[model samples]
Target: MANRLTPQQQEFYRENGYLVVEGVLSREEALAYRDEMHALAERLRAQRTVNATWPSIRAKNPNVHIDHCHDVQFHSAMVSRLIVDERFTGLAEGILGPNVQLHHTKMFIKPPAKGAPFPMHQDYPYFPHEKHTMMAAIFYFDDCPIEKGCFRVIPGSHKLGPLEHQSPADHYLPEDKYRLEDALPLPGKAGDVIFFNYLTIHGSGQNESSEARTTLLVQMRDPTDCPTVQTHESRGQGMMLAGIDPNARIRPVWEKE
Candidate 1:
């Protein structure tokens, strides 16, 4: 039960808006999650419920594909346990303090050759919170190199707060201003995780490698922080990951009996 992140790491995160921690999960653990993800994808595919491409990406290039599933814990028990695991939650606590709550979880599988690329943008447009405490931890299930479309970010971008996105419905920064080429690529090996604030401007390139890049992204926030907009609500949204929810309150009932 030691501190998962050091003072230096915390400082880097606060200053640069992101931090990459290696060996968060062991090799064996990462492999297990990767296998489970593929299995789940197969199951969802059979049911014709798996949409392997995003609409925006498709509009740009029909060949490119990036398979994804939201609320992944609801589909896999292993993932459900992973969200609350102290090793992971410890990182959340380090950033958001003791009382951490789950915002949502998502799994992304960037296929080889034709993986979709995400344009640089802030997560605030999707789900804006009052305290700006919302952050994400992306768990790499396999080695992710620059060629594999590894995550990229603009250091200190979070300090700029929420910038104007291109479209309210479809979130992205203007390509002319925030070019992907200008961002720093953060290549990571299996078991590594990258944590960044919601206001940080980030994106990734297409996976042109032979292998797929699989990752699980978990969004967390301080329980006391309230959302500015009621959006992106998930079945497991309010679940506490670490410590107690200080903002919890009993709901009032209307006497109709």
Candidate 2:
């Protein structure tokens, strides 16, 4: 992958806590992933699977739909391939390091109109590590305009090292809690990828578009560091996508991934 960041680009990420790499995937490739996910989502719907919801992020209403497929790498082969793809690995190495392991993959499909916004929060709080090497790579499968609730991030917030986020109790800080005069809106097209720091303060607005805003989030971390508390069944783990796990141990859930 010739997509390695230049010194300036790397420095920008270091100083801003977030960077967007345009055209990380081709339009056809992004469409392919979207097709697979839509099919999977239908299957889940047929099985009567309920998606995880935000109980209090909404400013207007409650019980809005915010669809998600957790640990998608375990359920979909195409997603697993994307998680270990050399392009994403390069982005991770550019920021975190050369040696990184896949923590998990999640698919966020925010539907039109009724989709709720995610409250302002740092990703590090949910999955804190000993060294805070965790990073997130989000690939947009659909065009993300402001109408679709594009990601809004605070520059250099990662350096703040996790602020007091107590909005919904043990979750996120409400968007209204901060002034956000400096928040940067990152509107993306299909195939764009955003790599961000785990401690970065970020969130999205309500989806006002007619189409769903789809994104695939791959969380990667340095293997030497483990999560302070495992939130999901295998939140801290899965099959290592890059380098060897320095703190490898026998766990039954790991083999399942």
Candidate 3:
């Protein structure tokens, strides 16, 4: 927690819209996180069929799956500790100012030879903040090379504002239609962390490697932010991660019968 990004690193994030840091965690810890996440994924996936409820599943192809868990932090204590750990919150604080709040926690499991491609998209469209302080931290629990479909991003795209996007609705924007001719791949070993802006244009290729890629994505924001739309109820709202929320106050809600 004491270790934070250097001034140069912060500048790099501001300029490039992303930063890949190595040794943020140990191999054992990363694998532990992966094991815990995969266990939950399998259990949840078995109970529901992407049909009867809120927990949704997005497919990359016939064999590939993009597993998403909205309230993943509460499922396991290990993951809960990792997300709020100062090692993560410190880095997020570097880019997002002093105060930061956790927006959502999700784990991505791309099985070998079947991982899907995430079309280029900006995350800001989903749960936007007026201050534009939202960002994400991708924690790698395994070695992810280009063959495993590592993250691809257009550097400095955060400053470009919202661009024209197509479906799967708000979250998945087509990369082919954007200025991604010079996009770069971010490959990392276990324990590495990649931080990027919410507005960054990013996507991933299909996994052609033999090993599955397991990663945890943690979304955060400054606490002063409010939802632009009703995409989310106050499910995990006002949960402070780092520093203090000056606007922390009680709000009333009416009972529905």
Q: Please tell me which predicted candidate would have the highest lDDT against the true structure.
A: 1
Per-residue lDDT for 33-53 in model 1, tens only?
999998888887787755456
Q: Candidate 3, TM-score vs. the true structure?
A: 0.88
Relative to the true structure, candidate 2 reaches a TM of 0.90
The 0-to-1 C-alpha lDDT of every candidate, in the order given, reads: 0.87, 0.78, 0.76
Clashing residue pairs found in predicted model 2? none
Best-first order by TM-score: 1, 2, 3
User: lDDT per residue, candidate 3, 1-257, as tens digits?
Assistant: 44588999999998988999898998998988888878988888898733211111143235555566666777888887887788878878888878888777777887788766676788877776677877889998999999998988989988898766665444555545653335798999999999998899897777789988888988888777766765544355556788987774564121123
Q: Is candidate 1 or candidate 3 better by lDDT?
A: 1
Candidate 2 lDDT by residue in tens digits, 168-241? 34367655665333467899999999989899888877788899988898887777766676554465365677
- Candidate 2 lDDT (Cα, whole model)? 0.78
Among residues 3 or more apart in sequence or in different chains, the pairs in candidate 3 whose N, CA or C atoms overlap within 3 Å are: none
